[model samples]
Target: MKKHCMGRVVAASAVLVSSGAIAFVPASAASATEADCDGIGVIGVFKAVESGASFNYNGRRVELQNESALDRYSRAEIKSGRKAGDRLWVDRSFHAFPDFKGIVSDQSAKSDGWKMCGPYTGSRTQSVFNANYAARACAEIDGTTLCGKWYVD
Candidate 1:
C-alpha cells in the first residue's frame, strides 16, 4: 500500500510538473525529470526521502524526495551492492544521488517476489513484495527492475 501511494504521488507529480502548475518546485526540476538516465549506472536502492515518501528495495526501506527520486535511488542501490535499507541522499542541488558504497553486505541473492518466512500481518514486517501489489498479495512473488521489485533472501 505504501508503494502504491508513493507511486501515485510520483505519477501525480509528473502531471503537475509537466503542467507547470506545481509551485515551490525548483526551476531545475524540469531538468531533473529529463535526466538522460539511460545508460547511467544505477544509483542505489531508494530509502526514505526528506519529504517522507519511500519504497522497498531488496527488502529494505528507502525514502526519497518523491517517486521519481525513489526510482533513481533504487537502481543505484542495486548496482552499487549496498545493503538493504541503506539510504541514498538525492542532491537535487547538484542533480546527483550519492551513496556510501562501503556499507554493502555480500549476501546471497534470493528469489524474486515477497519471501515471507512467517504469517502475513499486513504490516511492514510481513514480507517483501512487488511495489505494485500494494499489500494485496502476501508477496509480489517476483523481482524486476521495471516494476520496482527488489527482494533478496
Candidate 2:
C-alpha cells in the first residue's frame, strides 16, 4: 500500500509537469540589502551626536565628520527626544537617485529606547527609516538588518 501511494504521487507530479501546470523555475538570487535599494541605491545617514561621528548604512561603520552638527543633534535628542515633524533627510543625489526625506512621527518607547517611524517621500523608492533611542537609524530590507550611527541622539 505504501508503494502504491508513492506511485500515485509520482504519477500526479508527472502529469502536472507535463501539462505545464507545475513548471519549476529557479528563484532569482537576492542580496541582503536588495530590497533596501529597490533597484536604486540607498544611502543612510545617521549621526552619533554624543560621539561626534557620522554613521553611514552603506559603510556600516562610523566616521568623524562635522563635530558641531553631531553635538547639536546629540543634545537635542537627549534632552526632549525627537519631536513630531522632526525631519530626517537623505540626499538622493549622493546615492545617484533623487532627494528623499522623512519626518518623525508615531513615537513610542521600547525596552532599549524610543522608536520613531516615518516614511521617505518624494522618491521612486518606497522606504521608511526608524530612529531608535540609541541614535541609530534602522531599516530591514530583504531580510537584512541595516543600521547607522549609535549615540545618545
Which has the greatest TM-score?
2
TM-scores for all candidates: the values are: 0.17, 0.24
Runs off by more than 4 Å, candidate 2:
1-70, 74-112, 121-133
lDDT (10s digit) by residue, model 2, range 1-153? 111111111111111123221212122111222233222332343233322223332223322211242222221111122233222221111111123222211111122223222222111222222222233333322333232333322
All models: lDDT?
0.22, 0.24
**Tens-digit lDDT track of model 1 for 1-153:** 111111111211111223221112111111122132222333334342222123343554432221244432222222223443222322111111132211111111111111212211122221122223111111121222111211211
Model 2's C-alpha root-mean-square deviation from the true structure amounts to 21.3
